[model samples]
Target: MIRARQLKDWLPITKKEIEMRGWNEVDVIIVSGDAYVDHPSYGTAVIGRIIESEGFKVAIIPQPNWKDDLRDFKKFGRPKYFFGVTAGCMDSMVNHYTANKRLRSNDSYTPGGEAGFRPDYATVVYTKILKELYPDVPVLIGGIEASLRRVTHYDYWQDKLLPTILEDAPADLLVYGMGEQPLRDILKAVKSGVPLSEIREVRQVAYMAPHVPESPDWNTVELASHEDCLNDKLKYAANFKIVEVESNKWQANRIIQKVGQRTLVINPPYKIMTEEEMDASFDLPYTRMPHPKYSKRGPIPSYEMIKFSINMHRGCFGGCSFCTISAHQGKFIASRSEQSILKEVDELVAHPEFKGYISDLGGPSANMYRMKGKDESICNRCQAPSCIHPVICSNLDTSHKPLTEIYRKVDAHPGVKKAFVGSGIRYDLLVDDFNKNNQDGNHDEYMEQLVTRHVSGRLKVAPEHTSDATLRVMRKPSFKYFHKFKEKYDKIQEKHSLKQPLIPYFISSHPGCEEADMAHLAAETKDMGFRLEQVQDFTPTPMTVAEVIYYTGVHPYTLQPVKTAKSPEEKQVQNRYFFWYKPEVRNWIRNRLTKLGEKDLANKLVGNTYSHSGNTPKQHKKNKSKRR
Candidate 1:
């Protein structure tokens, strides 16, 4: 038995540190692709801390040198219980390469934000290395990479349907989703002397077996076989539809897909964490700082950005086709109690580095803290991926009072001078025209509170695209809703005499979006006095409906053909529209729009006619009207 160390600031990493803690053997050794950051926002730290809280001896090996003589894998020898492998917070391929398949020069998760610290497919690499060194030790993989790739899915980098990570890595188990509940269950089963091989009943876990196990308790849903998907794109598309629906359901059934001779079984996920459970997870002792070892190497950019931020909930019901938050975090909101949130705020106030400011008090969506389905039975029976998309669900409680109250409580902190909602707000929720059945009828109050108190200088919201056709494909509401939201936002700003900018974020080159659509977006936003400083070219990541459409050229739900900018040139041309004001791109935009027979759009975007003040005459008049 390993003697437990008195709770240390961070988990032990080196053998010397392990020995100093009086641990001859650790129950779990976590191997990660990211540099160690002992903050709750970082997954490795959270998981390591949770395991330590369970009274198990846990140590971490972060950014292990996979190219070396395998010393990192052998340094800890074999953990007594299991080795947890993760590709850090992001998928490894996404971390290593750009959407255009070009290698990135920096990784924000690293100590110095440098790239190439970890290998491509870091989860598979680390787990395979561990298994090669210690075949007897159990290896379990988790994190964003494993969670999104837990089933047969399209790999954008590889441009093929890859089997689940379980088939690729020689791991005994794979944990998916938020991981806290499933991890606790795994720890309990393992502590009870259940062999890792036989721990198949744990929820949110996946493993391979020679044949499907007979479990009378579970109702299993088999997906398209890996062979069938490989042979036919339609089968592959159809399979994703099943996987996505099962994933978002409240009471999901077990999912099984055959891969060659073995059967891949994914146990249903744990129910959404209750308020108490969410509070408990956040209340776990966290230093909320990067491990001291990275002091000289420079700060992890990702950690620095959110060190002072507080996550109020876990899950996004928006279910944007391009986003994986719902798939990984779940569709329901698991919010922290107000007390728990206030306690965290108080702790931030006491931190030596704190400067009378709480960076952010938000989650996946800032205003979704306490929002949920008004009727529990309706939500349980519902399989819709988004509660707000297409239209806000009638059963969803779109009230923002609870969120506003939380903001008020945080702002009331004597030590906190300001608490900003850095996360993007679902503007549709606050628009009366968009959310017609808002039960609380406090949309104006919520918007007023957010704009006057919570916003630091600018409030950010994602309109994504202006085209209703593309917006529908993206699972986002119509752009008209955004216009209504902006009208309300501008009215509030004028009423309060505040000059806070309502920044809207947009995406270019998303699935089903054409260059013509992007040009229209650029023209419309420009007409509305937006130069579009916040914009991104859509990069298809794994396990998103957008990615499925991008790779397969078909919508997963309807099996209809969808157009995507596949080539670098196609994507670049679409992205150029976002920067029509730039001199270098002005001619390029004019020529492209002209070539596409969109002369009017080109004139709107980059017409020669302009006022001496460098503003178009029409734009000047529109800006003047806004001042009135």
Candidate 2:
């Protein structure tokens, strides 16, 4: 079903492509840190397509060389309106380094799965280059890197508190969160002749000015200045509480923070996008493939993974303390109409590479599609960061009927042999012990459908941690609910005579987790006959409660001291518990736990059966090599 595509199908990425379009100058030039993949899953493509859909000439410069003469940036020359800069789908530092700050060998967004294409602090680096080359031209920055760093935050890679990204990048403006609505607003104003620096009324944007703009229409909340935060950690921690609360609200106040002489103004975000607006963004004329320029370099790993997948919705209401989804995507869900989703399904099925298998059809959380508060007025007056945390909201609608119908319809498609839900599901939502809103037995029906049809042999979920103390600090439900959910999942499996296992994800060295907590987590999951394949050592990224706690040694919401493993040795010791089944580390675990007076916990893990031998280690290594 695939056909030869014209060069003009995608947004222009090269000078020749722009020339082919017969445009003398482009209205916008997007400089990105990721290889240009013309898919809705990629932010650069979405923004570029939005610009083109708005009737502006937009071209992209993907992964421009920062070390060279900067010709890649200059290739497009100056855009007629402004230069759009993004550090791509992920933050540059996160993409470049591992949790231990070791350099990563591969970049998923790069062709051939290679690293070293994008520099560290890519947004700042790219913007600096553009500002130096074209000082008179305006530069605008957005994406996860800019959105999460819009306020003063702790940069884990640098191991220090940093000011707003606007100060470092020196861009004219920043459009935070999902940029569709704010981007359109800016485009309209610019087309109407409003200067970039003068358009200060757009929502979901942050910019620096000499003083606060006078706006009587909205209330403003001033955060601790960058200087004050450097002098006092508590002040910095306090600032995060305000930022997170306001970010999740319906009618949020404008946030202003002083950084040196200039004031960083973060306008309140736009209300969650309606169904129509969400559809328009996804319904753009995306070629649904990487630009032809990268065909010789090899496939982009991230693009290939999601090429056939569809994102049914946006945003997450879970608001886990360690996560950035609710921070960057907001707390409310913006779902696409089923018509738009099916339309994409048809397009995906036509791809030559799609062999009747859809990789995934999910969003931030798989089950959150078409979910939101039932009463608008109640949501408008609420300020809580999480909707389903602590307890599900009374006015919120948690019905799974719409999602079940969508799945059934997709399964009925003759082109699709199977549609897998690869995205991690929020298992806590389906547990009757935790969620009281499922009185209509929608939960049972949905679980049956999902377990029977959607699971790809192993269904993935995140219990995060087993310890109640650690789970409380993480703002997650009790692990007891996970046990309940597993029981139900097992029953559903038995009913269908299926053999799909639940893959529960866990974290070590999180903000409130201790060495003993990880020990308990290992033993608990081990009792359930799990080898613990999915696990990670926590990395403190910017704009999350865990990061703030890791830096300040206290909870932002309660200001209570919370213990965190900081030193490399301490973190390594905690992480070892996740792999208790490995014989190589059993002796180490036993010794460390006994030293900490946790011999009982040690017995549960190593079971007093591990002993170090002079030649056993060599024999074990030889056996491992033979298997390989």
- Top-TM-score structure, candidate number: 2
lDDT of 1 by residue, 1-628 (tens): 1132233667888888888888889899999999888777889988998898888999999998998667887787778899999999999998888767889999999988988899999999998888888888899899999999988888888888899888899999999999999999899888989977779888889999999898787899999899998899888888888888998887889999999999999888888999988887889887777777778998799988898899999899999999989989999999999899888888788777789877788898988888899899999899898898788898998778888888888888889899998999988888788899665668788888989988889999998999999999999889998989988888888998999898999988999899999999999999899988888888888789998898889999999999999888999888888987776777777778889998888887888533434456688788779989
Alpha carbon lDDT at 17, candidate 2:
94
Candidate 2 lDDT, 1-628, residue by residue in tens: 8676888998888889988988999899999999999999999999999999999999999999899668899998889999999999999999999888899999999999999999999999999989999998999999999999999999999899999999999899999999999999999999999989788999999999998889786799999999999999999999999999999898999999999999999999999999999999999999899999998999899988898899999999998999999999999999999999999999998887889989898999999999899899999999888998788888889999899999999999999999999999999889988888997999889999899999988999999999999998888999999999999999988988999999999999998898889999999999999999899999998999999999999999989899999998889988999988887888888898899999999888877743553224457677668879
lDDT of 1: 0.87
Go through the candidates in order and give each one's C-alpha lDDT: 0.87, 0.92
Please give the distance, in angstroms, between residue 138's alpha carbon in candidate 2 and its true position after superposition: 0.4
Off by over 4 Å in 2: 610-628
Candidate 2 local lDDT, residue 55? 94
RMSD of each: 4.9, 3.1
Kindly report which residue pairs in candidate 2 clash with one another. none
